[model samples]
Target chain A: MNIVENFDLFAPRLINKKELLSGGHRACSGCGEVLAVRLMCKALGENTVIASATGCMEIVTSMYPTTAWEVPWIHVAFENAAAVASGVEAGLKALRRKGKIADCDIKVVGMAGDGGTMDIGMQALSGAMERGHDMLFVCFDNEAYMNTGIQRSSGTPMGASTTTAPAGKVSMGQKTWKKNMAEIMVAHNVPYVATACPSYPLDFIRKVEKAKKVKGPSYIHCFSVCPTGWRCPSDQTISLGRLAVETGIFPLYEVENGKYKLSAEMPKKLRPIKEYYKSQGRYRHLGEDEIKMIQDRVNKEYKKLLNKVQCLEAWS
Target chain B: MAKRVGMEVALAVAEAVGQCNIDMAAVYPITPQSHIGEHLSDLVADGKIDAEFVTVESEHSAISAIIGASGTGARVYTATSSQGLMLMHEILPIASAMRLPLVMGIANRAVSGPLNILNDHSDIMPQRDSGWISIFVENGQEAIDVSIQAFKIAEHKDVNLPVCVNIDGFQLTHMVEPVEFPDQELVDKFLPPRVPFASLHPSNPVTMGAFAMSDYFTEILKAKDEALKNSKKTILAVWDEWAKMFGRTYKPVETYKADGAEILLLTMGSMGETAEIAIDELRAKGMAVGLVKLRLWRPFPFAEIKEVLKKAKKVLVTDRAVSFGGPGGPVCGEIKAALYNEAERPAIYSYIIGLGGRDVTVGDFTSMIDKVNREEVNTDTYEFLGVRE
Candidate 1:
């Protein structure tokens, strides 16, 4: 069990109290991505500036004449949040050194959704990370582009149906496996890279705080469950995220300074992947054969991750 | 004391920008704008300038980075040319709409297809509707002077718009000439540190670049339009202040030898100086020819253009970039629209000239005048100055 599992919603001690995101946002019901953003903001605290890409979060929070952001937030375009955040960080560095602004530790954050991060925004993100900017980029991966309807993005998992890649007579929904965005960020050799889910609030918050303190670039990939797009009951959002972890569909881990550390204890006898798949209507069309195929693929990928962790451990 | 030294125009512009005490610059290298970025980077690296020079991966990121920096109330700068400018086209209007008050130096060049990296207005012409306060420089000195003035004009309280200073690629950017740089103290006295209207900070957090729906979209656009339109007053005031301090006056539409001229040849960018030579030669031959140089592009100087062209009987409008099939050229198209409502407009002929580094010499100007005079008719459309069949 995780800290989130032991903590109560009405309790006072765990998460920070500052409300960086106002409650009046226009996100759809049971939006795990918005919850993740809220949790991330809480971890960021007061001295943070966010550059958001055009996505569900941006559209929902910033509808002219009104804003749900209690923090300084900027939305420049769809794919350049990372680039913009790099600029903001550089600007702050220059300003502070020149004594133009107050000398304080302010974190620059770039926030985007799956499509913005995995597809259109890949280049800018890679550049910012490579430049070693003191910033963090958070990609709220809800599998597909939910803001403009359920269009399949690079982050969309195979066997999950979407508007663009629907389950038709000859198609098996998304054609390819979900991209390992965390591994990709690790390849950038950024100081910190983490995979988190808002369902585990403490885990996500801890990773964000760790990233906040990193002097160089950091990345956090949040698995945001979209009930509206996933066609699941609103109440199942949290449980389904848990099911994903337990079934080896999604794992909770962090790589800090090239060291792999699991955020939570790996479930001892992984649950069947069918439990996670059955919770979402997106994968309802998959037959037994397709389910077995996905199950085998998940196990193989999990083993690959375990091999990485073990190899690093053996060296230590 | 101001220092006058022979320097490449691009390097001079970079030195001028460094004098402004800018907080940040995110620029990508693309010729002939590459010199501007390279010099600026050196200035930052060697502690010649106290600014952050972010070497961005692409023009898109360059514009994006500067926008983010400017949102923090820091004066920012970047330079690009041709396809680089096109890469920045997406964020150009966004910058103006947000009113971040950054400045960009454009080494104007032809846009691609054949992919020629040479001097032309094709790069900047397409950015006409991007709501930037654009201006063209004829020489290295003008480039340096206007580059300094750009920060002043952009950071003005009433006119918080990004300014684009266009120096024609290779034609002006590569030209080595003596450019007088204003004293650092004098520059400081003339241009104050940017007083941001609403900067992003933790103490006073604000949401910028908010998405506007149909209900409020028009009003937001209207406000940006009004800002660009009203920027003219601030531009003139800044230039007036510069004249007082530096003894150089600049006009939106500057005229040369037009006191009693009936035939006028209007031009923009670096070609204006070559045409001046042609005007001198033609005047020596007892011809009544003059020049109207377009200095300001956007918030298009309609009144100033009309006021200058009203007295001329025949006008030869030279545009450096073609407008495809729409109109003659971007500048000429705007000129035509500007004079369409006038009570008695002059007979106008537009020629797409000096494209893709095709040199427009003194002879070319004389030939264009001859072409207009020999063809006794208003050119409803433009003709390529010397493009072969």
Candidate 2:
């Protein structure tokens, strides 16, 4: 609340108007991840270079002849965005100090999807954070491997049926919970870590700006709704993102220098998990018992988050 | 002044790289390459060089880091061997195709199966088609010289490709031989600051490593191929400039006593020196034998290879790595491909020898020649010399 209290979100306001991620990107309609990237780019401003991992963001934006990115962007591989960003940050720092390039501090940012961040790219992200590079890594979580088609990823929720983890007679869907990537990054002792959703545009913008200014490594795990992958209505993409956050399934919070705090707009009373799951077709097969199980888990996670906020214990 | 001193080959190679004024180096150490990395890190830590030394978690991350650094217009370097090189294999072609002018060193070692960590070409053989301009070193002096020269060749405006200088593990890397390090002043004059062809900077925005569909994939790949092929010109020019400055000459394909000889033994890496000794002994006994060393691996040096084998009646190509089921040895297969369809080509004999660091002494070289003399060795496949069975 303290971080968000100073800003007038609607006034002659703060967020840069420059669209660093230009139009003509090939992202599918009702894609919340692209919108999140667009918001992130707005906060990152012009003095930034991005290293994108291979996924929807990379493929949709960069297609050889034409690129949607207006900033200096590079797509290296599937899982090394953080590693590449580390090198870019180090390179720029060395170049500036040695007088090779103009002396200026440029923010280096890494972008990846759920599959890239939670699974294959986890090691690289951990390494970058451990090395304490001055960079920000953003994982756009769409719950599944959306770009490769709606297959199960580590970020896929339990009881959600995917192509790979489809609900069969003898088996339930994606049998495990979504990975807690934000906490994993926090465990690396990075300077900043946050969970954001594009539906809360102002809160997300503030987090991005904060991450951009972090002196050491920072990470933002963005929960972006995938209408295509989740088998939901395209028009409800924004609403679904908001519902997830409101229901405490994906709480908007930040761990700044190891101190946890809830975002100002975090609902005083959490909505039921059933309301969050009702919008998507992936969880259609869940019975009353499955819904109750998910509800209890969400409540328990929310309570745990509240406890952290109360402690305000910054790691020494 | 060009200073000469006795130094371990890996440390000498690191010393040479330190003088090149690189901005960053990402290293993940493996056997034989650990010294090169440790020394480079010490150079940065001790303030001997102003560079970012990244000790990455894995070789995959190490290569990826350099690729990122090079994209931002930084002169970058890295070193790996054996499984480390195997880990980096996926990212190697990406660096080249991105046209990042970074340099790397390969302490050539055998890829493990029986878990050997000594000298061989198995690690680098599979990476030949990765589009990196590779150079093989014969000894410590050449290792140091070529390591320095690799930067110039990679950053050349016309070339703009990643280059890897291959020094045979232990054979060259562990040897304490005298090396002459080119003066920093002269090196600065010879190899100037990198002027990136295209860089990632806020002032000039660009998207690199874009996804290409079928329509543009082949054309993009072909362009990368041509850039690598045409890079030979810049490689020659850079090596020529190095020769003039340092007074130590180098060639794409170097020969030792092959002039008017009936049998020319082809070799690579540090084995060239030992093979030369064998050639001398054979020549003393009135045997017309000589040696041709392949210095440049990629951009193949097709003409130089053909030229060296022009008049020789028999070409004994020694390979340190097997191609398995196909071609036998990768090096010999390359040589055979180079000499294919020649008008009066020499009878090329493929002898797979000294794999996994089974020491190829002068005796092994003489025995290979003796076998070639008694019978027409099979041209279709390679014969492993001194197989225990």
Candidate 3:
């Protein structure tokens, strides 16, 4: 039982938390998306329900008569995940008012892919946030519409290759810049909006824990690398994620009320963006000029985010 | 015993919703369907009905609000038509999938393109696969009667699905007819309270909606499909109980003098009355003609339609909507598919008629019948009746 000693540290300290996500899922081998979800479930523990949209996660989890979700789960349409979660939260509250349910700390969490969070499901998300439902919305950003054959979505990074935004004779790759979903969530005036990457498991886990305690709507945007869609090595998923944060391409930050704070502060001397870009095949076709363009965009956005955080800190 | 009085179909539906003692109603005013919401709202505001009248911003919000309220184990109702129904296209499936027992009145109307607000099936036809049990009422009396029965069918634990009662806009909606208002005590006894499986309460915190990963997506969908399909028996049982209590009988497919008929005219909503008159005129002329009224559209009475149309040699299915490049109108195409494999099925001639509030008379129906008899029956086609060429 040498494995017991290895498990003792993370497992014993970990309260064999009721597993919400059962094993034996149908996700592809070494699927980082599901792995990120598994870790999220571990952090969320039991006593949680998730409202998911239609995507790779949904298709692979519940097949016919069997289910991989141990907890009570519901799969609505692609765009109404937020609305459905709101209904769940509202329904639970109503039952409590009627004195039907016991006083337990149960939470409702909404999970969806980038497309569902940033584009199609935006209205429902906005509505739920505006209504101030007590729930958590977690967006697993895998860049493109991985479930629907690598189509372009708002979360797809610029200069990345997708079926709809393929690198062509004239075009470099995805023409548009990645949508600022964290800022969008903050604009709704939700209680919390934070960005995390699976590469930083402790940080990602901490964000999920913080979101559960928030009174109103709390949003968590997790960067989940897609090996199949991003054309990267399966083993390089964590490294690529780490490179993203280190290169200042995807800065980790959180917005509490109106105050912005950088979760992981980076030094003024940052690594070259080329180190992150060249590691993935999706950006392999980029020449020096294209790489320079992408690096410039990333630097500008990061600087803007830093300025917002600094200004908010000074004012508060 | 209850006194019967003349009432518009929309008012009848409103009365039925009130009598059922629904807890919440989220509605938006739309043509033909406006009266249904207005009457219910008036009832709620005036203390005639103890319910929450949520005046939503749009039809989408109306349905969304109902889903939220219903998810909280409250009996909820709403009414909309044409573009209003189209606006609720996204939330419709969500309501059904969550297994909420929501009842809605759809004043059937032609969808806009040429900007028309007339009686047609174009509105409800697009929602055929939306997983709600769709019931069509021919007149004011049936609208009142069926609406009461709809709550029973929708809220039954075995049939936790949404129900849509469709009445032709400007036809049955505006037309006044004798409707028997059942006693409120009887309605309260017959329609039980809604028992939702999940709600948003702080005490017993059970989640109503949750994310299903690839590990469990198909099972949820299959369960939803089975629940909807299995609800047919409950729908029939509820209708039977309603008929027994109120002494008004209803069937999925109601046939009018179809026995031994050579030609059968099939229609839904108020147009069934027009077809009945056409049948009477043709029968006087020694023609073996009859009329079949479709009362239930979803959980589409396939077996009943086949049984009713078994004896007919020629079936004329007149639809008040067109399906563009599709197989004639939506209903006719569905009817065709239902009877496609039947060895003794009759010939179905689909005619798109009475669209955009065009007046549909007995004469117009007779002409369509004549075309069916002449073997000039247009199959997989559309013909707009009573229109200026």
Candidate 4:
């Protein structure tokens, strides 16, 4: 297997020393969030600064004198990463104007987990996007509060089991569908909004690059498979991310200026959602009826997205 | 050559910040503190000041955004009061611990319950251990002076901690007074552009606010504590320099007619002015009473407070905020602790007064002094002065 032989013509040019996110950190084995972050940094290159929310990524990468981040990074608080990113962008602009910093090409990236983006940090994230600052906010969506022992988050899909929303005899796991954060960001009328997966590295890298190019606030909701919380085989992290997109559970798409386009549209017959569910213990309690309920929800949402893409294409 | 004009205190503070040529400002609308953000926004809009004025959604983001902006090496400013301060309480320590040289103007107001938006120290009192250097002003001129000095002190090489300049809400923020705005050249010479100790630049690539475990957490906290405690010298040095350049002097604990007084009164913020008037009237009655106003609260100004109170036979401390079931008012409690180890300290008396925007007039001050002189109150605990029976 020649490393350079398989490079796709359309894929981002991968650089050597691509470990902006180095190894020897505390992330669980086969952590898909770290992989997504690495691909993002590869796309953004060395001239990027990150304001990370307090989560698995932050706690794992930055532990005192030891750090995995080769690029500049700051973690202020859990719910204010977006706000802090706003400040970083404004500060860089101010510093550039003052001639304090010569290079003005530095990009500010706001990184947060699903909990940080969908619930506690929603206000700050919305404010940052609405303010139209030049930055990218990436939500590594692992579904539940993986860093805090699998408590349920708004991003947790229905029928998925979590500590807070367990599948008891009388109740389902999560009562509601996963929050449509990418759509919520699109509602802010931002310049760019996209959803990507770590299993599809090229697509994830491409979306991050596109987000970087957009002038104002851009957002990318990346699907990160948490093996620890999901109780799946550690080696199955990347496979689960792939299965999520293929099963129409987590669609890979982008909204550019209200124009929707699916980055990886599924085949004529999408893979059964049960395949994705059965791979993780979070959904082990779901019976046939529960699986059908999730499949119905997934199908309805996927059709809605497809209709949006078709409508946009017709207008164009 | 300096420009002196009568302006509203909040606007004056905005103007002084403008004069410092800050790179960005994050504003949130909170009463008494709103006008400062409004005026700063107008300044940014009118191009009177070249800065980025971000109108944030809430006080939490306001501090959070400034933390980010300051992280990138931009000189930034923000303002809030009362509940807004409470909202910002969580992030205040982050700014100090990260050692961001940001400046904030707190229009001092009472924190709500009965929900009052009036003058008091309750807003800043609860934030005592947030690791930011706290200063208070007595008038509009001092408000402008201290607000300007705050940037310098915060950005000082040795003291790269955040600073808060507390101007009494409504009493100073809403009132118009003659404030001497320093010349741009003077300010330029005085405050060189902020030089951040560790900025978030892609070229340098350093991590800030990293997670520290038990092995290093205490030492990191100790370092931050030392920086705050050592900031007193830089604060004094900055004030001394400002006096030489602007002809206005400030001290941590400034006195009023305290020379050879048998009794002394302690106060913070604008209440010092009313206390002074009371001192004059009492001195005419040959009571030999004086006033000692606390200009700087944090680092507690322990040495100066002890030195000033050591001479008086009896000292009365006024606090606008309560410790609720504690021995005394918040300010008075600190005073007691500071003087606890002193070989010779004053017979201290604590009074809780002027709360929830209640007026404390010269008459009230005199009455309190009379009560103390007559030994009518218990020395062990604090009394809520001017309370209805």
Q: Which residue segments of model 1 deviate by more than 4 Å?
A: A1-12, B376-378
Model 1 lDDT tens row, B311-330:
78889999988888788788
True contacts kept of each: 0.85, 0.83, 0.18, 0.87
- State the lDDT at A157 in candidate 4: 92
Put down candidate 4 lDDT per residue, A53-140, tens digits, no spaces. 9999999999998999999999999999999999999989878876778856888999999999999999999999999999999999
TM-score of chain B of 2: 0.98
Please write out the lDDT profile of model 1 over residues A1-316, one tens digit for every residue: 6664565553338678888998999998889999999999999998999999999999999998899999999999999999999999988898899898999999999999989999999999999999999999999999999999999999999999999999999998998999999999999999999999988887788889999999999999999999999999999889988888898899888898888876664686789999898878999999999999999999999888888787887777
Worst 10 residues of 2 chain A by lDDT: A3-12
What tens digits encode model 3's per-residue C-alpha lDDT throughout B1-389?
Answer: 78788887688789888998777777888998999999998897788976667565567767766776676577778899999999999878878877889899899998999888888888988888899999998888888888888888898889899999998888889888888899988988898676766654433434444455577777778888898888889988988888799888899999998988999988888888778888889999999999999888888888899998877898888887787876778888888888889888887887878788888788988988998899875565667666678
Question: For every candidate, how close is chain A to the native chain A in TM-score?
Answer: 0.96, 0.96, 0.93, 0.95
Q: Write the per-residue lDDT of candidate 2 for residues B54-159, one digit (tens) a residue.
A: 8888999999999999999999999999999999999989988898887889999999898999989999999989989999989999988888888888988888
Q: Please give, for residues A1-316, the per-residue lDDT of candidate 3 as tens digits.
A: 5753555457446533566677888887657789788878878877776777789888787664566876556666787678667666665554455454566766878889999999988887887788787899999999999999999999998899899999988988898999999888999999999999888776777788889889889999999888899888888888888888888988888898888988753546668899988768889888999889989988888889889989999998
Model 2 lDDT tens row, A215-267: 98999999999999999999998999999999999999999888898988789
The DockQ scores of all candidates, in the order shown, are 0.88, 0.88, 0.14, 0.84
**Candidate 4 residue lDDT tens string, B199-253:** 8997799999899899998998999999999999999999999999999999999
Q: List the residue pairs that clash in candidate 2.
A: none
Which pairs clash (backbone N, Cα, C closer than 3 Å) in model 4? A87-B69
Model 1 iRMSD vs. native: 0.6
